[model samples]
Target: MMMRIIYPILGMVMAFTSVLHAQSARITALPLQKELKLPASFETAVEKIQYDLLENENGESRIEVVDENCLHIQFIFSTDKAVKQDDWQVSVTPAFSPSFHWAPHLTPTDRHIIDQHVFRSPALIMADGRQVITLIPDLDIMKKGTPVRWYLDLDAEGNRLVLGMSNSRVDDHVLFVREPGAEYPAGEVEIGFYLMVNRDEPSLKNPFRRPLEFLWKRWGHGLYQDGNPVDADLERYVEHTYNWAFNSWAENVWQEFELNGNKVGAPVFIVNYTQSPNYPGEVNEREFRSVWNQAWFSSLRSAGGLYRYAKRTGNTDLMEKALLTKELALSFPQVEGFFYGLIGTEMHEVEIDGKKYNRSKGWDTHYWGNSNRNPYTWNAAESPFHILDMSWTALLMLRWYDELEKDERLLRYAEQYAGSLLGIQSESGFFPGWLDLHTLQPMAHLNESPETSMSATFLLKLYELTGKQEYKEVGLKAIDAIIRDVIPSGRWEDFETYWSCSRYGSDYLVGKKVARNDMYKQNNFSMFWTAEALLESYRLTGDRRYLEWGQRTLDEMLMTQASWQPPYMYVNVLGGFGVLNADGEWNDSRQSLFSELILQYGKLLDSDEYNERGWAALKASFVMMYSPLNPVTKAQWEKVYPFFGKEDYGFMMENYGHGGRTNAEGEGMGEFTIYDWGNGAAAEAYNRILDKFGKIK
Candidate 1:
């Protein structure tokens, strides 16, 4: 019996051997290709020879040949990915008869191919046996703004495959291929590549488009009249606003009033308009402008000064202003050292040509009137709660001082100020938000709350810049107190929680409270300030908890929306209805209905809804008060109106016309006559938003 032995051809051998010569050839110009055998199973049958110029699957033009045993190929097109002469690989395969079934084997694994500055590997293989190869190059040395490239080789039977090439510069590239066979070169191939580049440029357009110019254009020109350019009037308004805040205001109250005896005027005490009854009680008809206490004015002036300075110089020109404000604030009457809060003291009465008018009532007895009454004093060992005003003022001073290049005089003052406050911190990390100015006794009634958190935030700043352990310790204590007490008690539960201590009846004193409007009353400024404090504290201590708490608080505040009324009016909803009727209306408060809403919504929190709401309110308020025109120039405007309409303006004038004026009734009655705190507050809110998100010119 004759037995025929059949030996199964191991396709593994073909794979291992087929690429051996190609690998050797890459390292050296050796004749390794000559030693390799073109497997008989891998056949190239030349029924016909064809010369064709074709673009390779890589988007490159190449010369190709067709024959029985193999199809020879040469590339002509060049790209960044095209392989250099030294990186090329070549393979050959023997022809097989048409009747013989020859299947080239492909093993997909984590193996990689390295070329000149490029590394290639297979990422995936489809169920149909199509190999996806990825190419990557060294990124460190790659030049910017360059294109990338790639190349591939196929055997005549297409049984053997080689990949090589270069392009601009890329991290990786990919190509897909099916199992090689006699018809390999004829099969479809796919190449995939990716690139990323940067395109950045500066522009002159206002990024934030603060309604400043827009409002001016709308009202300054022909918005009300027939035809007018209005640009001139708009420019005047811009200049006036800038000059008032930066130049005139800064130079006059901020800079002119120096601690070195150039005092502009005596420090005055003013009443909380809400707490006091209207002037000329029942019969006397006179317009009046609510005056703020010296400390309050100083704070306002300093803030305005800083804003103006930053705008004009792109630097801290307000350092002097801050220092002056601090000094004058420290010298406030009634309160010995630093003014704890707004004091309602009788300074002078409205007089015409030296005639004495009705004496004004004293309103300087309490801070926030009924809520906090602690005088501004810090007793190292006794004060129950550390007052935050002193610390905040000191912090603002220090920050401005540092920005102003660390003037030794300012630093010395700051150090002294910071040290005095630091002495009052308790071992348990509690500080008072109010204290007796002369006795240095902590006002326990104020309670140790997030108000201290505000102070602690500033203390952290002092520690960071001065490397003072005491400040840091005090700051940490403040932070601890808030974390342990305030946060746990949900002091930040809602807008109302921000001012947990202040409430009228059941509602917090925010805007005019309408029973329907649940918006919490309180200064939204605290919201941004608290966030800033938390973020700054996190940076100083590198504590994860600080960051986490800050982020959480921020998230909560962002989700809460302010309540709104007719004409799309919005007021940052405070606790509940107190002064305003059920409809959210208020007749007693001087605050704008939506001042806090405008301040908190879009600017600090990045809420598009709030931003739109704020814009709408601003527009409505402008139209209601200012007739959308320049009062002085009588020019038609398009953007913003500085003052209200003539009638409204007349009302405002009358409201402020205490000496010899009649009380008028109507929107214009108390309009411009009385400087609406809401308008200033809203302006402040707008300013803050611009400062935070407005584009730098």
Candidate 2:
């Protein structure tokens, strides 16, 4: 019986190989043309690239390259043996030309193969400010049972953009693995891909929306479950979201600290938890914490959410918690002198439960198996003050003052921060990314960062709030500077996250001395930040150019999102954004943020297209929430992360990995570790959405 089955399979494999061999007789590699000034990076023109069809056996492989406006490569694999293949990968690597530089996407310098979660685009995009070359894998070949992973290798040896099929039978959060058996009837297969070279146009929309459309057809719009709406009860979802957040704070997130010799306990938002949902383990006895940091991840941001949710539901306890968060944020030490009025972006020494944490200023140092583990190394206590973080935090505080509380202290703090910014405004109207703690000179990245320029929005808001002409004048000047200096470069990236390594004029990166562009760009958050600032400029002055620029940046941001759904039942990919450039992972933290921006743009411009897109984004925001009300996602969530009990319903994980580990312990598609930025951001966005849209259900 075994022999009969084996013989038939063998016959099928031989027949397939013979057919492929016969069809490949006319396939030939084209000769390189020097007169055309063809790029040396072209693989077909420069190298004799080939593949072996049979395992441990040499077999005929045919390759055909078609040269036109785009380079098209077609291949057919022929094997003599009757071998079967259940797992296989096809990859295309492009050699980079010296004239074309790789775009900075904030992935590690040494990264190669990237999982779908972190895959930036279907194409490996490279640009030299003018021309953009994109190498995209054929979508047909990538639609296998397992999720697709991309291969991007860039170095002196040349660059490669390859696509591969992942192992189908993966455990929870498992990314790359190979089962030692074959399921396919034959090993014979065909693959094809193309590379297009084009001029980088300012009006360029996402040319890679094809994969999104394909997935929408295959999976029926990511927001739908069996043609029924998933996020129907936006009000209930918003309430449940807040409940989960308050519960998380009560259960695991509250940090008890003795500040200035006084016992203080408040809901502190940590970056992430890896060891367990409770307090993460120590890194040099310093606990991993977010502290009073970036406004987007700070407790102030969480407080904003708590305040709105409490107002909507009339929960006084939640409102008190909100006020506590605000107080905790303002309690951080402030700077004096040249950087007077700005709160120093330094970690403070506080005793937690009789043990002193933040002794060396290393929060989020070694939380989720990350490398930068030593507390003494790259300590925030020794780092320069991040002006972007300070200004953004102040902006949020001021907003709270204007909307709810007209606190005298809040107004004073805003005035001080604005005054410091006014004094340091450069002749070019650009603001430095970081300032020295003591000297108050520009410490990191002498060049203007589009991310930092977003502080201009705060100034505009303050100007409106206080009728300060100086704030308005400097704010408009900064906007003009962005249009003059930054827009032309097209490097509108958010580099604020990595202050240690994102310096321009100096070789000081973290503890090591490196070149200017060592850290690379972080994420697509800058595009949205720039867009928001530009849009605010447009709204304030009615400048059409600012509106256009805002639209362009918003379009650029939409490109970073996952347009395609991977062939995974456990994880949802559509509308999800990756953690970093080419880093290979996705998370649901920014979904509501993206939605808010899109909706704001839609309302400002009164465009139906953007409005529709915004609604879809809003739906995608809560798609990952592990709530029993969301039956589809609830069941799907259980499949990937079964550790969640009924109490963990409203919980959301930090990462929705394509194939990366879910947490330190689990090897699966999504993680179990919760983050304030993840769940907190969602809750805040939903609350704001409720106020704006008024019960989306």
lDDT of each: 0.32, 0.52
My TM-score estimates for the predictions, one after another, are: 0.42, 0.70
What TM-score, to 2 decimals, does candidate 2 have? 0.70
| Candidate 2, position 341, lDDT | 22
How close to the true structure is residue 644 of candidate 2, measured as C-alpha lDDT?
58
Which runs of model 1 end up more than 4 angstroms from their true locations? 1-260, 265-386, 492-529, 555-697
C-alpha RMSD values across all candidates:
25.8, 9.3
lDDT of 2: 0.52
| Reference-based lDDT, residue 519, model 2 | 26
Candidate 2 lDDT by residue in tens digits, 329-403: 666666652222212223456666776545334322312111121112255345566666677777887878987
lDDT tens digits by residue: candidate 1, 559-595: 1211221111111111101111111121112222332
